[model samples]
Target: MSWKLQSVYMGMTDVATHNVLLLLKSVMRQCANIELNEGGNLLQHSLWVAYQAQAAGCESPLVVAALFHDIGHCLCAGDPELPDYYRDREHAALAATWLSRWFPASVCAPVAMHIDAKRYLATVDPAYRMQLGRGSKQSLENQGGLMTEHELSAFSSHRQHEQALLVRVFDDAPYVGECLPPYTRYERIVRSVMR
Candidate 1:
């Protein structure tokens, strides 16, 4: 899709917020290469994840997090430097950190832990470990398993674990229909959360 980000602040309350949106727009313009499955695009992938997060009963913060989880891909230029790709881990932490001012920790927590959660799952569940994609597996092998108690402790403390898992599940869920339909879903989720 043509990533023509209309340079409009619409309802943005402050300059900082407007700037962040501009940043997103700029990144979208540059990241035309990202493609989602079956004629889908990065925008669709983002919206779908947010849509499903709302449908799956995720709260507002989590829903928002789902929507912007991959925004960092545009800014950081494809997944921030991390130790593992074995589980398709990326720059979730960096994204989460940047989002902190705009969103609550409850929201950013899952976004931040998205990568570590994959690593945690890999270590705890062999079945899950087996299902990881090639990129994930390669990263896991290269990074080795979640081998420290501190890492395990950190993953455990994240209150967004369940929500993060929900986001993860939908992130890869089948996109069976037109992407336009999901936009409404995303809107509804965001509205519900904001309420």
Candidate 2:
């Protein structure tokens, strides 16, 4: 069965473990409803980050952040029937702020800074700036994504910032077919983090 936050929240884990995966799974389900480009699902995005994290030798907190970074977008993409601009300014901050109430600093810190991680790469990594989708680039220039130097500096110091950076990076990677990686991956991550 598809995982739900409420189920895991009431499961055997303590508050800390429950909250992290609960929040992640909630976002995962929300994102699952979104098309990852044309015919893709957001669950693949989460799995991709988890696989990428392990390949890069990352540990628990960063790995966890990688798995849940874009969760905010799924949670707060706003009503589909509403106008595009009829939404919050920063999904990252919204996710982070909500996460801050329960997760460890290592996890929430990167969730909070994931947007800036994108901004910093855009500024410092010319190739990265070039690779952004038209909408993402537009968001960077016109929306609040372009980080001030101070914000960039502050974000650079956070733990697992690199992993968050990877999340931001892979988020734009070619959309694998919807459910390409299957539900099992998401299930494992959710179960693992919760336990």
Score candidate 1 by TM-score against the native.
0.68
Clashing pairs in 2: none
Separately for all candidates shown, the number of backbone clashes (residues 3 or more apart, or on different chains) is 7, 0
The Cα local distance difference test for each model comes to 0.64, 0.65
Ten contiguous residues with the weakest lDDT in model 2: 82-91
For model 2, the superposed segments whose C-alpha errors exceed 4 Å read: 1-27, 78-89, 175-195
Which tens-of-lDDT digit does each residue in 1-195 have in candidate 2? Answer: 447876786574566565665665666777877665434566667667666665677766666677777666677665576444323246667677776665576766677676777788887788988878777776676446666788778778876677678777666566544334543454554444432
Total colliding residue pairs, candidate 1: 7
